[model samples]
Target: MKKQKATIHDIAEKLKITASTVSRALNDNPRISEATKKKVLKIAKQLNYQPNHIASALRSGKSRLIGVIVPTANRNFFSSVIRGIEEIANSLNYKIIISQSYDEFDKEVQTVEALLNARVDGIIASIGKATENFDHFEKIMNKGIPLVLFDRISNELEVSQVVIDDYLGAYQTVDHLIQNGCKRIVHFTSTQRINIYKERKRGYEDALKDHGLTVDPELIVYSNMQLEDGRKKMEEILKKKISFDGVFSASDYAIMGAMQVLKEHGYKIPEQVKLAGFGNEPFTSFTEPAITTVDQKSIPMGKITAETFFELLNSPNTDTVAKKTILKPELIIRDSSK
Candidate 1:
């Protein structure tokens, strides 16, 4: 038969001390003598004793665990954000459990539910591209767990969120192209249901209106914003014989595909068809005629999100107003947009 694990009672018996004293010593209670703690620790090492974190969490009602959900891990933007979150969390002695939604609504729901079941102290997330119903997020707050969202967020949820100023970013991108003589600029995006895309689209239209240019519905194209969608959108424009001098994509992935099609069609970037995209992905800098894009400040946004979670943890005021932080994006000038 396997030997039974040593208990605190065994340690106390060996030391000829009370179990309460042994417990206090093991816990490093200031009331215990330093010599007694040293003795207890030595005995614990001999027995290879390990504290059960599950039991500790049950007793203290704190798991010291944070849950994080992101749309996908393939993008460097999300990875950089995670690094920022981890840096702050490690300093604060908190562990984080990360989950990827793969841009699927069902996957997001499942990940959120699993984290709730794990009894995480808090959650930080960016809503998936396909996520529409926000009841799962509300359920987290209803249970008194602090919730923070970043990048993709919903205004309906009264949770703290860190996000980029998509409207201003889009507006500035369009203004740059217009100043460079891109009269028939085309806007590439996915659905308007997501807040970021919606704001970007609104900014694009508003900028055109501000410049006394017509808002051509034909100039705006909407799709999944995937690689295939980007390629197809470019092809469709050529087939339709639409005249355009510039392109503004809501995501770097879309622009990457669009650029390939543009080059194949003998278009000279910036000189002929200026191009820009959101999210200053690493590839944007290395691509031939490096793509001009907007820096979302993803890392700082993650740090702020984590800091907000700490604030929520320490706050005594239950009615603390949610912090809605929006970071401004900087336009990165590159060969693609000049």
Candidate 2:
């Protein structure tokens, strides 16, 4: 009813050679003569022989494949990071599988399981915003799979991580606003309890304290940091008649929303109320008053993430110490904050 697929043994029998010699010839092994390799290839083609990569990987114990997980693949930052990862991986004769979590907790756990089942040699990921319990990630370490995290990471997991210095970025932004005579500044942050936001908030408070500005509860607004969330929070702040000369948001999208609301309220940027945002999204530069922001060095972050993953993957020691790579953030001054 069904035809049998051709194997190395089939080609070997036709050429009167051993199966091992045929296998070596098919693989282009240096031990096989060029004449023998060409004959084996010809016979393989005639017999319709197909090599099973999965079986070969199982035998060798290396898939030469890496899995990469991100919150979303549509963002320029995330896409750029992936590009950097691909450059290094392709050069090393390895390929990558990408998965998006969409910032959901359950989706992240399920994706981790799927990648593991796919038999990826290692995994590189950025934790989702909704993820708090890291049991899934712990499972990876328990199974002895190399896991590398970048950008959005957890302190609870003792895995290798690559991230920019969020605290310094926030501090520089607030200090820049203060230098530009922006007193009574309002800060927009998230209550997600992620290290990035927490670090940014800490930097914001420290800058205010160091500059003789009291941290006012009314000036601090916490939200999801989306564009719509930014507008709603900004509107609520204005409704309370809060006096603020500057606005610094942890997200560029949120700051853009705040800018729209401020414009609608007849407030001129920089002249009336200085504005700044973190994460130098491309849209930040396109705004009427280009927003001052921090560059997270996505390309470098991705390259370093991949490099760290390879380090763990190649290590012979099972109990290798976890490492953390922190990149410096660059403060991009723009018209919005000038």
Q: Candidate 1: which pairs clash? A: none
Cα lDDT of model 2 by residue, 185-223, tens digit: 899998655888989999999999999999998898998
How many clashing pairs per prediction, in order? 0, 0
Using all chains and alpha carbons, the TM-scores for the candidates as numbered come to 0.90, 0.89
How far out, in Å, is residue 175 in model 2? 0.2
Model 1 C-alpha lDDT per residue in residues 1-338, reported as the tens digit of each score: 99887888888989999988987787679999999999999998998877554555776788889999998877889998998898899999899999999989899999999998887888999998788898899899888889999988888999898999999999999999988888898999887778999999999998898998888999999988887888899999988999999999998888888999999999888788999999999999999999999999988988988999899988988778999998989999899988
User: Model 1 — TM-score against the truth?
Assistant: 0.90
Alpha carbon RMSD to native, model 2: 2.9
Largest lDDT belongs to which candidate?
2
How many backbone clashes can be found in candidate 2? 0
Candidate 1, residue 2: lDDT: 100
